[model samples]
Target chain A: MATTEVVVSILVSTLIGGIIIGYLSQRSRMCFVGGVRDYVLVKDTHLLKAPLAFLIGAVVVFAIASLVASMPTWPWFITKSLMPIPGAPLAANAAVPIYNHIILAIIGGLGIGIFAVFAGGCPLRQHVMASEGDKSSMLYLLGFYIAAVVFMAFILPNIQIF
Target chain B: MTEQKERKRIIKHSYLIIIAGLVTGLIAALLQITAGVGPPNAPVAYGICIACHGRDLINWIVNAIGGTNLGYGTLVAGVPVLTVVGIVAGAFISSTKNKEFKFRTTKNPGVSFVCGFAVMASALILGACPLRAVLRVAYGDAIAVVGFIAISVGVVISAAVIKVNARRAINREVT
Candidate 1:
């Protein structure tokens, strides 16, 4: 297929996949951070099982996928440089130092963890809860959207570890 | 009786989580294979992420209507990923269908909003949300592992604090 066709196909696939995921998540009440929190605080394995299964399922599928296609960048740490996968600032480039990425990951992960606990769920959970007509989650998403713009404009530039 | 119990266990919520996780992996792999990643749609494990994909979707719309070039992942350069949109739609449909949909208001909208803002800022800094972090770890990224560990630590810390506060409240009531 042509590039445009491929993009469209991927978009449709993602939408469908997302629908499946969202439906399942709603039914299951699957929240990764919640799982970790529950297990840590109460030793409740009930919620914890889902995220572990998620990790295992993804790993097994990813391993199989590598055999079917030429995943040159599949195992990114070994194939590419030690820098984390490109989802952050300078995502497409390798200009940022390795340590910067590490530091960013630490700070980012901690912030997400702490705030998400207070917010009552992770991002995915918040989105689902908002859809369920939770007014608080809707407000949460409002801030989430606004912060995306603010991060790109204000926070991203200053945090560049030059 | 045992057969019925077995049937119920098979249809448990955890099973749905497992299916969702496997399907998520399959979607990511299929996108990579068919779309031919790198340029215009980079980032491995780009299938399903709440934070990154959500940001990309917003950026795509803003850039389209406002004609402003806000930077975003190359994957959504042409069209935004609709995973988050689909999530909301799907969740809404499922909740209503299951009669689980209810309008629940919060006492602390401002606090929730601030927490949301902070969560997004940190997630972007890390460059992935929890779901994406798991994907990266599965894809063999070492840094994501560190991030995951730090996230666990943070969760533990907060959970402990919350537990302590709850206990204190109980103690005060007893007094």
Candidate 2:
């Protein structure tokens, strides 16, 4: 396939995937926190099933695609490279040293987890919720965008501890 | 007798939920592994991250500042925009079909906004959100595991807060 064709195909597939996933999530009323909370609060399990199903589906698709197409099977799509400082140790590949920085990783994870709970959803869940016409989720998404811009521009540069 | 039976059913359901969650995590991991390798003859991974593309945008910006190339920014931001737009469009269609479309908001807008900001900021700081984080781990990024553990700790803490608040609300109602 030509480069343009390849790009177009990928875009189309991604869109289809996102749409299908989003629709399914909405129909299922799947919220990650809600699922876990249901289990914790009252032992309800309906909401949790969708995410589990999603994960399974994703894995299966990935496996098939990897084997058939000779693609890398790891989740490189989701990995973001950390900007290494001058003194920071570099991994063999472009993998960020931050992956090895246990302390910062833990702190960052704690923040994400707590914030997700407070927001009543993770970032992905917020997207799903927004798609469902949840106004609160839209607000959350706005906040998320702002935060993303801010972190990338300002906060990330000063943190030497990580 | 009815209450006891209900409790037993609930317990059974909870087990199912746990199993489902574990399975989902594993599946997501598997997908991450497959997608990590770029598709045959393609420089880009088939399903590269929606958010990491944002980071790539930042990289482009930095490169631009350094008088380097800027062509890559479009690709970085483009995929996420398409994915999110697709998500919204899909939801709309589904809601239309199900007759579940409605504009709704919580009682407290301010709190919701704050929560949203917090969630996004935290996600940005970690370089990926929960979904991305898990995918990162699946792809063999050891750092993502730390982020996931931290996410669990955060969840527990927040859950405790919810519990306390619920208790207080119950006490107030009782009085």
Candidate 3:
């Protein structure tokens, strides 16, 4: 297909996929951080099951897809290095070392975990909540979208600290 | 509809999540197979992510309308992924249909904003949100596994902190 067609198809497929996931997410109040927090605090498996299910489902589907298609990086751990999949920073500059990627991942993980917990839901959950007319979640998304621009433009450039 | 039929129609949350996951995986893979969205341009597991896709979508719009060359994933250089938009629309439809949509307001707007800002910053650092982190791990990215462990550790700590705070509040009330 042509470029415009490819873009349109991607947009359509992703929109449909997102809508389905979002509908289910709103019904279930699915939150990954909430899942981990609930299980950690109370040993509750109700929400935890969603992330587990998602992992298993994605893994199984991806495995099936790999059989038919030639994905050079299907199993990234085997084909690529053990480094985390390159984020914007690493993606921009491939020369960043593996250890740096690990460090970044740890820092990022901790921050995401702590803040998401404090904010009351994961990003997806927040989005669902916002859609359900939660003002706080809407504010959260406002900050989220702004920060995305700030991070890409300013913060991402200065984060060379190893 | 009969109560029994309605009950049978209500799918379990686990099944819903599983279906979401499977569809997400299929979309990612199909994008690769049909549209060639991988490797050189897009990374593996580039299907669905709250943070990355939101960033790419917003920037794509900004660059298009404002004539600003804001950076975004090359995978979405042409057209922004509409997943985030769809999520909002879908959730709105679901909540409104179920009569669950309520205009709940918060006292501390700043707190929510800061939390969102920090979350996005960290997500960009980690390169994936929790959902995409799981996707990366599923695709066999070892470092993503480490990130996943760290996220779990953070959650444990947060849970402990919240527990302690709750206990403190209870103790204060008793006193």
Candidate 4:
């Protein structure tokens, strides 16, 4: 396939997948923040099932698919060690040092977990909220992209810690 | 009221909802793996991230509308996350279909944006969102376990804080 053809295929396939997932997400209101909150507050496991199932399903399917297909698979986690190799792309073939993983996990995870609650939803929930015309969610999304861009360009380079 | 009732029924049927969620998640993952739409299955699993993918979408929009690119590789890299766009659009369609599309306004926009900032920053730091964090664990990235633990701790702590604040508010009202 031509370069343009490859890009188009990737985008189209991804969009279709997103549409399928988002439609179901909207139908079910499957959200991690609400799920965790409910589980903590009321001992309810109902909402938690969505994320758990996604994890389980993704693990099983991806493992089996990769094995069966005999295609090369990247490491299970973010590969930071291979990145900054002088010519590697940011999105593809990037890696981080193993020592840094610990800090990133604890602090990063806690922050995302906490703020997702304050934001009133998970990432999936944010998309649904914006789609439903929630002004606050839209603002949150705006902040999301802006911060994402700035972080990737500026903050990510300077951070020696997690 | 009817729409609300219907939503309640759907939630109440936990088994059906779980099955549907599982199917959709599996299909999404399968398609992403096949399509090779992303770097790998780590911090970004295809186009699933809100913050990262959202940036991609926003940059495309901004550039299309006459913003100048500085010619840096990242600045000029044109990977528009149409999946994220499709996500919101699909959600809009579903919300409208079920009559659940409520236009929610916020009393505090500053805090709202702050929450977004916090989420994106932390997600970048962590190298993944909560969803991908769990998957990272399954993928055998042992480091993510600590992150997952922290996520649970954060949730439980927030719940306690919220409860305490609510009780305080109630006491003030009663007084």
The CA-based lDDT of model 1 is what? 0.79
Q: Residues B62-155, candidate 1: write the lDDT tens digits.
A: 7788887776765543677778988898899999999999999899999999999999988988888998888778788899899888888878
Worst 10 residues of 4 chain A by lDDT: A82-91
**Model 2 bad stretches (over 4 Å):** A62-100, A160-162, B1-81
Pick the DockQ winner. Answer: 1
Ranking by TM-score: 1, 3, 4, 2
Model 2, docking class? acceptable
| Local distance difference test scores for all models | 0.79, 0.55, 0.80, 0.68
Q: In candidate 4, what fraction of native interface contacts survive? A: 0.64
Residue-level lDDT tens digits of model 2 in B68-115: 432222242233224455556777788878888777877777777888
The candidate, 1 or 4, that scores higher on TM-score is: 1
Task: For each candidate, report what fraction of the true interface contacts it reproduces.
Answer: 0.70, 0.45, 0.69, 0.64
Q: Candidate 2 lDDT, tens digit per residue, A102-162?
A: 5555766687777778778766667767766788888877776655556556655555343
lDDT comparison, 1 vs 4, better candidate: 1
Q: How does candidate 2 fare on TM-score?
A: 0.70
For model 3, what is the C-alpha lDDT against the true structure?
0.80
Candidate 1 clashes between residue pairs 3 or more apart in a chain or in different chains: none
Which stretches in model 4 have alpha-carbon errors above 4 Å? A74-97, A160-162, B1-12, B38-44, B60-77
Give a tens-digit lDDT track for model 4, residues B34-134. Answer: 66554432233442555555656665665677664411212213656466777887899999998989888899999879989888888767666676666
- Model 2 DockQ reads 0.36
- TM-score per prediction, in order, is 0.91, 0.70, 0.91, 0.82
Supply candidate 4's per-residue lDDT for A143. 83
What does candidate 4 score on TM? Answer: 0.82
